[model samples]
Target: MKKYFNWANIRLVLIVLLLAFLYAFTTKRNENRKLCNTTVEFQDGEQLFITHEMVNKLLIENKRDVSSIRKVALDLNNLENTINQHEMVEKAEVFVSIDGHLKAVVKQKTPVARIFEGSGSYYVDYKGTRMPLSAIHTARVPLVSGGVDNKNKEDLYELFRMIHDDEFLKKNIIGIQVLPSGSLIMKNRNFNYDINFGKTINMEKKFKNYKAFFQKAVQDSSIYNYRIINLKFTQQVVCTK
Candidate 1:
C-alpha cells in the first residue's frame, strides 16, 4: 500500500509540471503572434457617425500599420483612449482576442438636436454636450437657432428630451427658436403657425394644454386657422390669428 501511494504521488507531480510547462509555452507563443486582423463594431447600429476605416486609421501608431504590430507590443488602453478622443465617440473598448485579432467596440454619441449658429453648425447630444458635425451621416433631428449657448444648453436639452419622448411632438415639431428673453418658439410641420412656449417652466402643463387644444382644433377642422399658439398660460392655450 505504501509503494502504490508513492507512485501515485509521483505521477501527480509530473502531471502538474507538464501542464505548467505547456501553459508557459502557449503563452509565449501567443505573445509572439502578429496581429492578424482588426474589427470595429458600433454599438448603435442605426447611427454610424464613425466608420470602420476611420477607427482602423486611428489604430495606426508612429506611421506603422496596426496589422504589422505584435500582440506583445499592443497597448489596448492607449488605443481606447485614442479612439475616445473623437468627438463623435461616446465610449470605446479595444482588446485582443485569443486568436491574435484586435477588436474595437465603440458607442457613438446620440444627437438630440442640431444647432445652426452663425455660419457654424453642430449637434447637441442627449447628454447636452456639443458634438461636431459628421461628414459621414446626418441625423434627422429638430433644428435649433438663437440664444443657444453653453449657459442655456442644459435647459434646451430638457426641452428637447420632452419633445423626443412625446411621439406627437417628435413627429410634428421641426424647429426651435430661442428668444433673447429666454422664451422658446417652435415650428410645426405641415402648419404655418408658430408655438409660443414662454419658458421652460410648467412644461408638462403647457404641453398637455397644447395637445388638448390641438386635438380639439383638428376635430373641428380649424387646425390651420391660427398664426400663433401660446402655451404659456397655466391651464389655457391662447392663440393669435
Candidate 2:
C-alpha cells in the first residue's frame, strides 16, 4: 500500500510540471507571434467625423506600419493614448487579440451646434466643448453668430441644449445671434420675423409661450404678418407687426 501511494504522488507531480511547461511555451509563442491583422470599429452610429483611414494613419509609429510590427513590439496603451488625442475622438480603446490581431474601438464626439466667430467657424459638442470643424462631414445643427466669446460660451451651450432637445426649435430655428448687451435674437426658417429672446432666464416658460402663440398665429393665417416675436417677458409672447 505504501509503494502504491508513492507512485500516485509521482504521477501527480509529473502532470503538474507538464501543464506548467505547456503554459509557458504557449505564452512564449504568443509573445513572438507577428501581428496578423487590424480592425477598427466605431461604437455609436456611423462615423461622421473621423475616417478609418485617418485612424489607421494615426497608428503608424516612427514611420513604421502597425501591421508590420510584432505583438511583442506593440505598445497598446500608447496607441490608445494617441487615438484619444484626436479632436473628434471622445474615447478609444486599443488592444491585441489572442489571435494576434490589433483592434481599436472608438467613440466620436457629437456636435450640437456650430458657432461662427468672425471669419472662422467651429462646432460645440453635446458636452459643450469646442470642436474644430470636420472636413469629413458637416453636422446639420443650428448656426450661431455675433458676440460669442469664451466668456459667454457656456450660456450659448445651455441655449443650444434647449433647442436641440425640442423638436419644433430644432426644425424651425435656423440661426441665433448674440447681442452686445448679452441678449439673444433668433432667426426662423420660412418666416421673416425675428425672435427677441432677451436673456437665457425663464427659458422653458418663454419657449412654451412662443409655441402656443405660433400655433395660434398659424391657425389664423397671421404668422407672416409679424416682424418680431418677443418672448422676454414672463408667461407672455408679445409680437410686433
Candidate 3:
C-alpha cells in the first residue's frame, strides 16, 4: 500500500485516472451531442442527396414541431443519413450556427476524363478514379479513337485529362490524335496547325515549349502560317517554314 501510494507513484496514478475520466467524459458528451444535432452545412454543388429544400423543410418541420433543442439536433443528424446512401459521397458534415441556420457540406467523387465506350462513356479523374459520363452532349472534347486497347488506356485518359484541366490549353486543344502505337498529337485551332507531340514523353516541358513556340510564331505570324508543328525532335522543333 505504501509503495503504491509513494508521492511520485501517486501523482502518476492521479494523472492516468484523470486522463481516463477526461477521455470517457469527452467521448460520451460528444456522442450525445452528435446524436441529437440538426444544424449542418452542405458544400455548394458537392452534396449528392438532401437538396436545399429538404434541408429547409427539416429545419422548419422541427422548428415548429419540436420544442426541445435535443430533438432539433437529432433531426439535423438525420440529414446525414440521407446523404450517406449515395455511393459517390465521400463524407458529409453538418454545421449549425448560433443564429439558427443549418449547413451541410459533402465530398463527392471527381472524374478526371471519360472514355467513349458502349454509348455510355466511362470517366476517370486524376486520382485514378473511374465513373460514368454525364447524360449530356459534350463538344470540343478530343474524340478518343482506337478505343482503350490492352496497350495503355490509362495514359490516354490521363493525357486528355490534363489537357481538359488546363483552361488555357483546353481551349487550344482542338483534338487529340492517339496513334495505334499509344503516341499522341495535339491540334491547335489558332491556325488549323497540327502538332506532332510524338510518344507523349516529357509532357509538361514539351507542352510548355510547344505553347511558347506557338506564341513566338503567332508573334512573328510566320509559324501560324504553317500547316504543321512537329515537336518530336530531341533538341529542336520543326515546322513548315
For each candidate in the order shown, give its overall lDDT on alpha carbons: 0.87, 0.87, 0.61
Q: Give the TM-score of candidate 1.
A: 0.90
**Colliding residue pairs in candidate 2:** none
Candidate 3 lDDT over 79-116, as tens digits, reads: 66666444444456655654344466666555545456
Query: In lDDT terms, how accurate is model 1?
Result: 0.87
Considering TM-score, where higher is better, how would the candidates rank from best to worst?
A: 1, 2, 3
Query: Can you write out model 2's per-residue Cα lDDT over 99-159, one digit (the tens) per residue?
Result: 8888898999878889897789999988998899999799889898887778887878888
Q: Candidate 2 — what's its lDDT?
A: 0.87
Off by over 4 Å in 3: 1-91, 95-102, 107-111, 135-143, 149-151, 164-167
Per-residue CA lDDT of candidate 1, range 34-89, in tens?
88888888885644687888888877554456668889988889999999999999
Roughly what TM-score does model 2 have, to 2 decimal places? 0.89
